[model samples]
Structures are given as C-alpha cells and as structure tokens.
Target chain A: MDAKRLTLFAGHYGSGKTNIALNWAYRLRDEGRAVTVADLDIVNPYFRTKDAEDDLARRGIGLIVSEYANSNVDLPALPSQIYSLVDDRSTYGVLDIGGDDRGALALGRWVPSIIAEDDYDMLFVVNKARPLTRTVEDTLEVYAEVEAACGLPFTGIVNNTNLGPETTAQTVLASMEYAESVARATGLPLKMTCVDKRLINDFAGQVDSLFPLDILELYYMQKEGM
Target chain B: MGEKVLMKGNEAMAEAAILAGCRHYFGYPITPQTEVAAYMAKKMPKIGGTFLQAESEIAAINMVYGVASTGKPAMTSSSSPGISLKAEGISYLAGADLPGLIVNVQRGGPGLGGIQPSQSDYFFATRGPGHGDFHVLVFAPASVQEMADLTGKAFHLAWKYRMPAMLLADGTLGQMMEPVELPEPHDAFGTDNPWATTGTNMEREHNIVNSLYLSPEELERKNIERFERYKQVEAEECLWEEYLMDDAEICVVSYGITARISKNAIAEARKEGIKVGMIRPITLWPFPNKALAAAADKVDSFLSVELNMGQMVEDIKLAIDCKKPVDFCGRVGGMIPTPDEVLDHIRALAEGGR
Candidate 1:
C-alpha cells in the first residue's frame, strides 16, 4: 500500500469521499508517516471531516477544516491553514474535497501549488448506489465536472459503492463490474475498492487493493441509535 | 419498490415526492434542507416536471398553491425560518381545501435560528401554521427509510383529505444518510377531484377555489365543514408506533430524531431493570392521543423527550388527561439530548426522583 505525498478524494455529493479521506489519513499515520488532512469541503453542511477532529488529534494526525465547519453558519469559508498542505512538504496531506463541481471549486486555489509538487494523487470516488451517479455515463459526467472545477485531473478511480449502514459484502461484490467500467472508461487505474471494516473478513482473497473503512458518519449516528 | 440505496433524508423525501406523482416543486433553499431543493432542481426538469426556485419562500408556497389548485400533486420544502415565511400560503392551502405537500425540515428558531436540528416547531406545526383555524396533517419521520415512506403517505393522505400535509423533519434527520428502499412511482394524485379548478369545458360549472367569503354565515359554514373532515382524519388517520409498551410501568413519548434516541435509552433502562417503553407518534397533528391515553392506564408515569424545550409535553399531558405524572427531558437551541442523558432521565424517573 503505497501513498503519494498528497492524496485527494473528490466525487459527487454523498459519494463517501470524506469517510475515505479520513480512513486514508489514519492509514498513513499507522504507517508511521506524518499526516495532515485538509477538508476543503464548503459545499456540504453536514458530514465533514471536522466531525472526526478529536479522533484525528488523538491519532496524532493534524486536521484543517473550514473555520465554520460545524458552527451551523453555512458560510463557504475555507481555513487559511490549507496552504500548509502544499507549503509543508514534510507531512503527508490527505484532502477531502467537497461534493460535485460546486464543492470542488474550493480546490482551485491550491491547484497550482499542488501541480508544482507533481506527486499528488487525486482519486475520483464513485458510488453506484447514489441516485445521481448510478451509471457509467453519469459518473463520467461528474468526473469531468469535478476536474473542470478543480483544475486537477483524477489519476485513479476508487470504487466506494455502498448503501450506507446496509452495505453488505455482496453489495461490494456486485458493484465490481460497474467500478471496473468506470476505471476503464476514464482510462484511470482502479486504485482500490473500499469495504466497510465490518465486512472486510468477507472479501479475503476475492478483491485486490481492498481498503477497509471505519465509516465515521455511520458510526456517529448508529452508535447513538440515531 | 427499488433496491436499497444510501440517501440523505432531504434527498430521500425529494425523490419520494417525485415517485408519488409530485410533478411540481417550488422552494427556496435553506440550510440542512437545501438538498431537497437541489435534488428537485436537477431531477424535475429532466422528468418534464416543473421545479421553480421562486423569489422567496412565500412565493414558492404560492406556486405550490397554484399547481395544487389544478388537481396536480405539488410540493414545497424549507427549514425553520423559510417555513415561517410560507405560513400564510399553507393556511391558504388548508382554507381552500387544496391538497399540497409542505415539508418542514425544521432547524432551531423563533426568527432565523441557527441551522441545526431542532423539534422546536412542534407547536408551530401542530397548533396550525397560520392565524386561521386549521390543522395540516403532520408526519414526523425518525429514519431515512421512513422519510421516504412517509413522504408518499403524506401526498396520499393530503389528497384524500383535500388539505395540506407536512413532513416534519429536523436537521439531523434531513442530513443523515441511511439505506432506504424507495417507493415505486405511483399516481398518488387522486383521479376524483370534483372541486379542482381545472377549466370546466362548459359541460359543467366552473370549480371555484377560494378561502375568502364575504358573508359571515358562508365563512362559518366553510370552517365547520373543514373541521368535520378533520374529525374524520383524527379518528381514522392517526398514526403511531408502540415499542415494548406492554407491561411497562414507565412510558417514554417522543418523535422524529428524539424518538430514535429514546429507543436506545429505553433499551438501556430496561436492561437496568426499569420497566420502560416508548410511544412514537408518526402523525404529530392527529397527535395519537388515544394511544397515549391508553398507555396512561398501564404505565405509572410518562417522560416526554424532545429536541426543543418540552414543546410536546403539553400535548402528552392533554392526551393522558393528567392521569399520571408527566416528566420532560429535552435540549433546546439545536442541542440533541444524547442517549445517556435520556437514560439518566429515565433512571431518575424509575427511581421516583422526578
């Protein structure tokens, strides 16, 4: 499991990008690498990486989110701390880009610096279970929109197809062809398939580059019986 | 029915409204519930439906009124402040006996409150949204699945009763994601609307839709007639869910997200040897009084859990006729009462501390 200096997750809204970014940051930290997560999500009012701020801090991972992330203000204000991602080359940066083209627009300011580094991996996360990105054509449409908005092309495709808390091993298995089609259509490498940690045991030898996710959003609500 | 998919409560309701034959949607965006308007804006045009982002919440609801008057399924959604702006239009829908789906994905507020989940609008919704004497059929969904299911139900019931129906959701429910099996697309717009203001072909008299009556006698008669329909609704349309109510000495009353939190509290209380249960009102307007009244006979006491400052406590007292001690446990101004907080309340009640 090799990670670039910077790994960015961008996709359509509700495509599980925030959750994947958090998981990737944790993986980087566990591998004894200095990690910092920059949440450039101004599009979504709920389910930002900042929701896991305390957990990230405890794990020795630095987090940079909107100044008004969970303040209920709904202002599209990104933190100035995001510049540290590109300026500070000593730490591994994981970015949780906002949902859709509107969300990805926040990435425009950092694109030049990130491109100068030439080592960032911007992965387009796809979830077939979402209503909007249900087809290959629709997924590609979102991919193009996100890329156009952020001025960054995706170098990899991550199959994050899920049904939230109801995701099953079979659901992941069934979405393989769809994920492969997306990867093939975009001519990008199939970087990984994200499976919920609860179901990781079910995909022992069947899948490659299987990334186990400790779904933080689901954990927050379901743990509280909400 | 469709395969299970992950959807936010706001998006699920928008999709469910479309499935229920709501071809017309008019709304102004507000936080925590903006996904509803966004989803409609994207899907409605593609489906040949009308999705208009009106100039204001007031204008959006009036657009709904216009479409609903023509006997088509129309809807509008907003958060707390936005819903307040549409109050006059909702009252007009009720007064004119027009069927329209009005979704209030509530946020904390008296005036432009913060954009966080709050059930503080219980009184605003149940008592009547506007000045006139009217009750909009209100459905509070606790889960994302119920968010989609009850949306279809709200449309069906609104048309059946010839009045406005509101899907009362809080910000937490509106934003949270869960697996939901969406309802099959259906023509919930009833075929028989003799009072609809569809242009009469001169074969029949023009159907007039109006709430204004100059004559006092005519206005009184119209009010009485609407109340008669409401009586029928109260009797046959009241919806509620009773969880572990049998043989329980302590009853917990809640709805929407608070109800989900209470269930967990009830489970913990039960494990601690407290005989506790829950009665979740699915229909807030109809109030589920009969169920609460019956629960009063079996339970020693009741606890009303809410996200507001005990707004639903008054309704619970009225429902039970003050038969037993009713305690209130709640958080206000967008604060959610955690399961442990609710459990502690239940434990105190069980110990006769409150």
Candidate 2:
C-alpha cells in the first residue's frame, strides 16, 4: 500500500461536504492505499460518511469504528482504526466531519492530537454555489469560526463547487481560483479540488490533481455487482 | 420497488416502516417529530396504511398497543415530554414482550425542555423508560440515513427478540435535511407472528400480550428471560466508534452531535501538536463500554462532552473505572457546546497532564 496522507474534509451544511469528503475517500481507497473513513456527522441528518458504509464495505474501506456503528445515537467521535492505524505506518485514514461552524468546533478536539508529531493535512472544504457561502468573505468568516472553534489554523482549502449534475468546468475553475486566493492569504496549501462525478475533466486545465467523485466504490459496484 | 428519492430522517423513517409492511401508525404531533405523523397522514392512505393523530401521548401509545397486538408492524413517536407520557405504554410493551417501534426525537427536558435536540435521555432510555424491571433496545442515530436504516432494523430486531425497540433521536437529527438515498420499497412481511393477539378462531389458542404478570415466580421467570435477551443484546449488539486513540495521549469521548464537534476538535488539536482523539457511542443502552474501556486504557485522559451536564460522563467513568482522569464537557439544557469550547476543555486537560 502507498503511504497516505491524513486528509480531513471540513465544511458547513449543504456545502457539498459528504459529497466532497466521500469523493476524496473514494480516490485514496482506489489508488492502492489502505484508506479508511469515519463519519463524524452528529450535526445534520442527510448524506453522511456512514450512509456509504455498505458501498464502501464493498471497496474494502472500513466505514465504522464502533461496534454499534450501525445503531443510532450519533455520538460522533474518532474510531478505533484511528488509534490502531496511528502507529502502524501503513494505514491512511480520512475523517468526514459534520457540517456547520458548530461542526467545525466539534472537530477541535481531534486536530491537535492526530498530528502531534507527524505532518497531516486538514482541508477546509468550500462550495461557493451554496447559499450561506457566496463570496470570499463568507468563506473566510467560516474559516475564522472553524479555526476559532477548532483552536487551530486551517491548513488547506478544497474548492468543491458543483451544482450537482448541472455544474460545468468554468464554475469549477472559478471556485478553484477562489480557494487558492484564500490559501494564499492564510498561508495554507491549496489542497485538492473536489469535482463532481460528471465534471472530472473540468479541472484538467486549472488543477494539477483534482479528486474525483466516488469513482472507487462506483467502479467496484459496477464490476462486482455488489 | 418504488423509485429512489431523497428523504430526511423523519420522512424516511415513516416510509421505511410502511415499506417494512407496517401499515399502522399512531402518534401525537410534536416538534422534530411532527414530520413522522405528517408524512404518514400524507401517504398512509395512498398505500393503504393506517395513520392516527391521537388526542394525547397516552392515546397514541395505547393506539400502538392495539395495532401491535394484531401482529403487524405498528409504531408511534414523540418529543421528550410526549415520550414521558408514553412511559406507561412503554412499560406495558416490555412487560407483554410485545414487539413495537417507539421513537423519541428527543428535545431538551425536565418539564417542557426546550425544543432543541438533546441526549439527556441516556438514563431514561437505558433504564426501564418507566417503572419496571425491563429494558428496551435503543438505537441512537447520528445521521438521517441511520434514522431510516435503523427504523427498518428496529422493526426486525423488535420482532426477532419479541421486545420493544426505540429509535432515540434528538431534535437536530429529526429536523435536519440531508440527502438520503432511500431504499426501494420491498415485499410485505410474510413471516407468522407467534405472540400476536390474533383471534383464536381457525388459528392457534389465544395469545395474551400483556405485562400484568403479578405472580412473583412468574414475574421472576419473565424478568430473568428478558435479562438473558438483554445479555445477548449486550454481547452481540453494542456499537460505537473510536478515532485516533491507538497512539492518542488524550481521548475526547462524546456521542451524537457532540461527538461530531469533538472530532473537529481532535483535528485542530492534532494540527497544534497534541495527540487527541475521540470515542463515540452509537448504542446508548447497549453501550460499547468495552471499546471505551479499551480506549481509556491507551489514552492518558478522557473528556466526556455532552449537551447535558455530565449525564454520559458518569457512564464513561463506570466503563473505564477511573483508569484515567475523566473530564466532563457540557452545555446544559439545549445549548450545544461549540467545538472550540470542547477544545478549550481538552487544552486544559492536556496542559494539566490529565
């Protein structure tokens, strides 16, 4: 397995969080890395990391760390795989956090601890198409809220702007530019750009490497009929 | 199978039961849970389902008792206070060993607790829910999909074990709207129910589904048998999540919404060079205490954060047996502690070397 980066997808509600987060996880899992995902969405009740469990399980991606992972009571926390994999040096884990600034704060407890020594990447996922986030100021306000809540500087930004199936390459590039500007201002890296499953080619001109939509699990489901 | 649609927790759960062949629903309208009754009212007749908005929580629960006795899938839901009123019925369901789906889109409570989401019912749900030596299979959902997914599972578990099963959700999970890919509707259940109060004519002898066994020996036998089932549930069904605790020096323990916040806290703490992690429990009743206990063994400290004041904190202490300093993080009533607030607690815990 390839050595993996500890990538975190952080954002607000309806900000294409689970879509982008799940996409990144799918990318890493398919590239021959021992990648696992944990759903920490105790904030909202929609498409979350755990919603993709049965599908991810087919890709050999560990979706739950709780013995009661399938049950309700959404106590969002780190999974055992995180601790077991922390020292293993072979496993790469992705934690899909909840949406909302409140969710950003929820993430504070884990950030400082995961990278106590090793370097890891925390990507503040941004979607301009979302109503609450229409401009750089709005995104920055979110950034500040999350940073303050989490008690740490956001290290990177992932431009994940897509209006679902209607999104085009132009809008995707524009969003990438916006995220890069924020990254430059904050001194954090402009991490991967999150593109929709149908808009993967739109990033060819602007992004060096844009994470694809859940192509990993999609490919598996198609091939194995799982 | 029907076409796939995007649904919310409250909407999806109501539909899931109908898909599970449960045509009967009884409930009282309450915030966060009003959608369940509304959805049923809108769709029950379309697909030949029974929907009722009872006069009170008591009436709704009794309605459930009537329908559940018929051996078909039956259910009811309410907010915290309404759920409290249904405690009498919940106890009866347990005593009768009758399978039912009782949902609580928990709102904050002591009396009419605020209409916001809260998990303070950890005690009410895990304990008998009312006055009785009984327990219910409680599933706490962190996301909407689980709200739908677990509803189906709750029905199956309820019938499989012949017990009352509750989906303990909070107001947030109930009201939130996220993209949920609903499963296609399936065939109605064909399995025969052995304990339902169906007529004796042409069928087997009458089966009385009630919790009024007053004989001490009979009560003891029934309670003992129920305990065996609970033990099996504890052994086979306890569920939870652990994050970054393997080499974690400090662990943040939380559930539901709070757990999500704590995760971000861990992410932030890690960036600042602290080895903090998280432990979230999915099953509040059949708690994954063993997993948490194991987590405590590895971490130097544990912080139990909740929307209430130290309710779940006590549970954490019991599981780990004071293996480490267990710090409590909370914003009582209806206040949800921000991730930074939780981080501050963790920072203090780490700085203090707990």
Candidate 3:
C-alpha cells in the first residue's frame, strides 16, 4: 500500500471513492498503523464512508462523521475531532470528499490547515466507465473544477474503473490506455489502478501498482445472506 | 454493428436518438437526466446536428413541436417536474398528429422531489400525460442496453404512427452503467411526408399543420379518428417479456429498474422451490393486456412490484378482469424495495398470506 500521512480521495458521485477510502483505511489498520477516516461527503446520500462504521470500529480505526450524516438533513456539521486527526503526525488520515464543485467546499474549510502541514496527496479517482469521465478531456475538466473549488492540486491519479457488479477483468484492462492518456495530459503520476480481487490474476505483471478490491458494497448488500 | 462499450443509461439514450436519425434536440438540465443533454451537446455538433439548451422544459417541448412539424426527427428529455411542465406542448403535438420523441428519466415527484430513482409517474405516462382524449406511446427500458434499443424503437414508432412517443425511464436506469452494442447511424428523415408543413414552392399543394378546429363536429371527428388509430396500436404494439413464467404459481409484474430488481428476487424464490415468474412490460401505455390476461389464466395470483405506491396495479387488475387476486408491493419517495423484501412478498402470496 502507498503510505502517506494525509491522503484525500475525490471523484464523481458514482466513481467509487468511498470504497477506495474504506479499503485504504482497512489496509492501514491491518498493518497495525493508527488510522482515522473522516466522512467529508454531504452531497450524496446513498453511499458514504460512515456506512461502514461498525466494521471500521472492529478494526481499531477512528471515524469522524457529521452530526446529520446518513439522514435527509442538509446540515453539514464536521466536528472538531477532524482537525486534531489532521494535526496528529503519527496517524494516517484519509478524507473521503464528495463529488463536484459544491461538494468540494467541504474540503475548502480545511485547505488552510492542510497547506500549513504541507504533507498530503490528493488523488482524483477516475472510472472510465462513468459517463462524464469517459474521455480524457472530460476527466481533466472535472479535475480542474474540483481543484479550483477546493484550492488544492491533484498530485496523482487512480484508475478505479468498474461497472458495479458487472465489472470484468477486460473492463479494467481496457482503461489502461485511457488512464495513460489522462496522466500524459495532466503531467500527474499514475498512482495506482484498483479492481476487484477476482481479476487480480489477469493483471499479473501488467500494471505498475495494483490495489485488489474486496467488493465492500456487495458485501454490505448481501450481509443478511438474502 | 458498433463495438460494445460501457455507457450510462442517459448518455446511451442520446446516442441512440442520434443513430435513429434524430438531428434536432432541445432540452433543459435536470438531475439524473442532465447527462442526456450534456452528451448531445458534445456529440451533435460533430455530426452536423442541432443541440439546443432551451430556457425551460416548456420551451424545449415547443421547439420539438416546431421541428417535428417540418417533418424532421427531433426529441427532448427531462426528469419528473420538468416533464410535467412539457404537458401542454405534448398535447399540442398529439393534437397535430406530429411525430417526435420525449424521454422522462423520472425522479421522485408530485413536486420538486429528491434526485433518487422513482416510478411514481406510471399513471401520468400511461393515462393522461397531456390533456384530453389523446394517447402517447410509452416504452419502459430496464437496462442500459435497453435504454438505447428502446429509444431507437420509440423514434421508429413515432414516425410509423405519426404520434409522439415517450421513453419512460427512472433515475437508477439513467445513472447506472453497463456494456451496450449501439446501432448504426441513420442517414436522414425520409422526404415523403405529404402532411409536412414545408413551403409549397408552387410545385405542390400548400401544407398546413394545425390542431385548431372551429367546429365541434370536426374536432369530435378528429378525436374519433385518433382513437381508431390507438386501437390499431393496441392490437399491434403491446410489447412484453416473460421470464420463467412457464408452470409458475405466481407472476410478478414489473418494468424498468424495478423489474431488474425483481429478477433477483425471482431467482431466490425459485431456490426455495416456489415457482415464481415475471411479466415485464416493455410498452407501458399499451400495458401488455394480452400477455397479462394470458398469464392470469395459468398463475394463481399476481404481485405487482414497483418503486411507487400501487400505480400500475390498477391496470393489471383491469386487464385480468379481476379473475385472480392481484396484490401490490411497493415503496415511495425514492425508496427501492430490496430483493429479499420482494421475495418475502412472493412467498406471502404463494402461501395465500397476502
């Protein structure tokens, strides 16, 4: 796993950013590192980092959630605990931000303190299967909008391409050229590529860095064994 | 055949329309369905087509009316509230007997509702979308691939019947992504429409497109003729799908995303040795009465699963003539019933518990 003191995950709503954040937090906890995840998503209601609070707690990870998280209320109350987590240098902090410019404002509130600390990586996760980010130009445009809104530069890119449960090994492999095109245009390093663990064998000796996904969303859905 | 590529349902609908010879599009941005207009804005110019972002849904529908009267293929799309605003213009198009397409990627509604998927607009789409004694064909697609195929079907049917057709999809179908094989692009709208409102040019008789009639007798005559045409459509264009319906005790009736969810529930029920099946209506306006009536003869009962509060159940009941008890399982306000919940409903009905 790529280790950083402060890492930010930002993407479009259905780009699977929450799952990537959860995976990173779980991986860090598995390695016996102090991990803290802050749910900075207030725009979308269906999927969020707070949904895995119990699993996160079982692994000895701390979670910072809004007062009105997972409800219909529009109030954004990111508590002060998030500030201390960012300040704590010994712990790894992952912020799962929401999609679009309006959602990036949640991250803007912490930009001053984040720049003051000066050791962070904001990764713009791209799903080539998504409508708006299918092309290199469209993905760059979305990246620029989020950058302008949150006042942060995306240090790297992660090609986390999938079609929900219908994802296949071919789907992830087909995005390699597209991801390369995006990396070439933006001059950002290709940080990693994420895919379901079932397809890890197909990607052997292919990608530079591979993050095997555990299908957290489907696990939650079928948890009751229905 | 175009190569298979993954696409969102909304963008696929726009690409399908372009492939079906739709050169003119007028739409306003709304949640869950805005991708359709955005895709058109990007692709239409490259293909030498017209993509206009109208000021409002009403203006977009009126623009569709204008282009349609000129015998050109045109379309517009919106969500629930925006669709409600296009009601008057839809009535005008139907009254004038013009061919066009309208797409409704429905979100929750009654007012400016939430942005999640909902199927609450069944009654509005199938019964009285516009005003008075008019029928607009409605096709419901359950997947990203169907989203493209059905939009192409809608354009063809619109021209065949010289009437407005609707692709009634919900937010889940609009936002979800899947692999699809797109159709080949059509050349142009045929130039043989005699009733088109093209300038006379002194070589042919003058053509006029109007829905107004001063005499009540003439208006009544037009309405009767349109009803006759609708009867012909009902006889021919009622499309539906039956899944594992052979030798089943209960049938689950659904369409669009809800139907996709129901298939999962049906498979679960089958594992427990309960013979459950499905009848998915591809055309909602025709309502697939013949298929439902036929299923009523073999199935013990029916459970209509929807993302709305029992809207399509009334049509099912009427179709079967209340021969078998019809029950409803639904969720409202953008809430979707899980596959386990739907399976529980099926079990209850099979056990004569509902």
Candidate 4:
C-alpha cells in the first residue's frame, strides 16, 4: 500500500470513527481492492482493531496487531513495519485510530508522508449527543484541536448522531442536518451519513454518500460490482 | 409543548434514539438503567415505534437479535448482572457482525453486585461477558449528556463495523441530570433499512444472523479476519480525554464517575503545590493508551483511581509500562470515594510511602 493511498477514520470518543473506517474498508476490499488491516489500538480494549480479526481474515484481508508478543501487554507504539507498509502500499489501506485529540497527535509523526503521498480521507466522525460536541462550533473546535494535535488537516465530516434502539428516522435526519452544518462551518466536506442498511431505501437519496454499512455486505457489493 | 428539560443519562439515551430514527426497542428493566426502558415504553408507541418488555434479560437480547438481524438499528439495556445474561446474544451479534447497540448502565460486582454506581463493568464491556473470542465497540460516558450522545455513535459504529457497540456508563452517570440540546427528528416513514426484516416479499433472499461457527478452520480464519477489521478500527477509531498532562510531575488516570472525582482531586492537588495531572478516557475500548504512554515519559509517576477493585488500573500499567510507580486505590460495590479521598491517594502515592 503506497502511503499515497491512505484512509483514516478519526474523532473523539463516541464519534463513529471506527464505524466509518470499518464500513469504508469493507467497501474498498469488496471492490476487489486488496486491503491489509493492522490493529494499532493499544488503548481501549472493547472495540480495538483486534476485534474484527475473524471477518476480515475470512475475506483474505491481512491482519496485524500487538499480539505478536506473548506478554499481552502491547498498549502503545507501532512497529516500524507500519511505516514501511505505508511507504510500500500499492492498493487501498484503512487505519482505524483510537479516539481523543491526543491520539491523533501521533499522526503528526507521519504527516510528512501522509500529506505528501496519501490522497487520504481523514474523516471526522461526529455524534451531536456526545458532550464536548453538540454544535457546529463544537465540532469546529474539536477539528481545530485535532488538526493541531495531529498536524494533519481533516477532509470531511461524517454526521453520526443517532440513538441506539431508540434511534428513529427522525434522529438520523437530525444528525445529518447537524453534520451538514458542521461541515459548512468547518469547510470540511460532508463525506457520508451512515444509515443502517435497514433504513437504506428511506435515506438513499437524502445524503451525498450512502454508506451501506455492514462491512462484509459492502465487500460483497464491491466484489460483485467488479 | 415538548419539554426541553435537563434529563438523566437513561432519559437522554431514550430520547436520542427517537431523534436518531429508531423505531424498535427491546429491553428488560434493571436498576440504574430502567430510565432507558421506561422512556421507550412511554414514548415508542405514541411515535409509532415498538417497545417490548421481554420475559428475561436473555429473551430481551434475543429479541433484539431478531430485530437487528434485519439490519435495523436495535438495542437493549441492562445493569452488570443482566448484561451478563445477554452476553450470549452479544457474542452472536459480534460473530454475525450484526449492527446493534447494547447499553450497560453499570452497577457493582462480579456477580449480583450492587445497583449503585461503579466501574466494575470495565473489563466486561471492554472484553466480553461470555467465554468467547470476541469484542464490541465500547464507548464509556462520563456524564449523562455524553451517555445520550454516544447512543447514536454506538449504533452507527455497530453498523459500520458490522458488530455490536456498547454504551458503558456507571450508575452515577446514568442517574445524574444535565442540560442537553436535542437533535432534530428523522422522518420516520422515511427510514431506509432495506436489509431490515421490514419484510422481504419479492425483493430478495432472506437474511440469517448467527454466530455458531462449527468449522474450526473457518472460525480460526474468521477470528484472524475479524482482527483485520479491528486493526482498521484501532488505527483510526480510538479516543480519550487529556487534562493538564503537559509537563506534569505525576498523572492520574480514571474514567466514568471516577473521572469526575479525579478531575476535582487534580485541582485540589494543584492548589496544594502538587503537579498532578489527569487523562480521562472517553472511549474505554480505545483506551487512549498511546497518549498515556507519551505523557508517562514526561511525568514522574502515575496514579489510577476507579470505583472497582482496581480493574482499569491494569490498563494503565500496560499503557504506560513506565519505571515510575503506578499506584492504585478504589472503592467497590457502588461506594463512591470523595475527591479528598482521591487527593489523599495521590498524595500518598506521590510521597512514595514516606
């Protein structure tokens, strides 16, 4: 994977960054694009990149993580191989970074390569219901904070404010509207609005990007389309 | 007029689901988490949504499985023990890569623990409640407002990754009240979950969601493959909160209710001529280990405080893996320690047992 073909999903806690990354990765891979996933999360355990090991491997996707060590103590830092992999990348590669502005700060180390080579989409996942992020200005402030911390500019916003089982079409639409406002304020493109495939037909024409989540499904779509 | 009142974590989650366009809710009632079901029960029908009070926690989870399998945004809520009951279903969701949300309004304990606020569920949500090789996207909320807001992201992430997502909150956070600016309502009849079992008459083949992988080779490959997706998640999705860690002598690590207490403790310690800092992890799953590690390089020592038996403390030890002493102190079974208590712990740890 050329560092030039980089895909990043980033944002604060509860901002849907992982969700966007997972969906995007599946879509690209499904289109017969070779993808390798390296689980760089040494932070939170619940949803680490290691969590999706099974599904991605079944589709012949490459998976790498800290478990290479038997101590089960890998929490920080990435192998120099990651840099080499980025430097040598040919197809598409997606990286799901941990949340928090500080975590993004690590990206600064790779900014030179990231900016120079990658036509990457640094997607900002936003959940309006999250504290410290409920308004367009709130998102802009966070975007700035992340930009300064990571030393990389974000390219788009993914409106992702929805309630769990209680989430309704109303809530999804509201979230998208808020996302649009944030995108306008931040001048970041509103890349996509993720709606449950269950809500597919209802929201097909409503947003700019129809992120048909369910990673494997998109993989199938991509492969089938190709 | 609809009330624009300050609400607790439970109420906010319920209300946010509505605004996010959820129409079906299946859950069993449990303390410190009843507000979620209560709100759904009271409102789901009026808004033409579905809310079912299942016979047991397991049943509630399975019901959610049935609904979520159709590709709809479905959810269920329970305290620690009850969440344990639903572990099987959570595992299935992960195995099937189903997109769904599970709210864990944590109470105390390894077993029928207290209904009071506690962070004991940290490992359970971070790992899993069942004996399985699986994980969920866990979002830890420090306040009621965050609990409400993260609900949407949970569902969105669940769908995006084709896995289960969790909103891990403590009793204090779930019960606390706070002001919130609600989002706009989605057009209900305008939803688009084609994969949802909204009924597949002549459209396409039926969708089946299951996690029972009989083939060892298949399951092994599945495990490796899921790790691939997780890799992508870690690279781009981890999250956390940093407070005054720049050039500090020692750092205090905490989350949820304890995070609030830790913050206050830091303030007091600062006033007393101590340079203690804080790093609150917003996304517990993406534990913000890198930031903690970096800060550890600049600090003298680290102190970890939680409401459990020093559960998350292990994460701190692993993250920083520093030469400095990584001390820990906490109260369990819903016993919330005061900020002074945390300050005392910090001072004790900082003084190096002198």
Between candidates 3 and 4, the DockQ winner: 3
For TM-score, candidate 2 versus 3, the one ahead is 3
Which regions of candidate 4 deviate over 4 angstroms? Answer: A1-226, B1-4, B186-206
Report clash pairs, candidate 3: none
What TM-score did chain B of candidate 4 earn? 0.92
- What TM-score applies to chain A of candidate 1? 0.97
lDDT of residue B170 for candidate 1: 94
The CAPRI classification for model 1 reads as medium
Instruction: List, residue by residue over B1-354, the lDDT tens digit for candidate 1.
Output: 778888989999999999988889999988989999989987999899998999999999999999988888999999989988999999999889998999999888778778878999999999989979999999999999999999999999999999999999999899988888998888887688888888888889989988899999999999999999999999999999999998789999999999999998888898898999999999999999999999998888999999888898889999999999999999887788889999998998988943
Instruction: Rank the models by lDDT, top first.
Output: 1, 3, 2, 4
- B39-74 per-residue lDDT for model 4 (tens digits): 787578877999999999999888878878776777
**Where does model 1 exceed 4 Å of error?**
A217-219
What tens-digit string does per-residue lDDT give for candidate 4 at A4-57? Answer: 267777786546566567667777777788777654443332334555667778
Tens-digit lDDT string for candidate 1 (A1-226): 6989999999999998998999999999999999999989887876678788889999999999877877768799988989978899999999999899998998998999999989999999999999888889988989999999999989999999998767889999999999999999999999999999989999878999999998785336566756
Question: Pick by DockQ: which candidate is best?
Answer: 1
lDDT of 3 at B262: 87
Cα error, residue A186 of model 2, in Å, equals 50
After superposing candidate 3 on the true structure, give the runs of residues whose Cα lies further than 4 Å from its correct spot: A11-14, A33-91, A97-113, A130-151, A218-226, B45-50, B187-191
In order, what lDDT does every prediction score? 0.91, 0.73, 0.86, 0.72
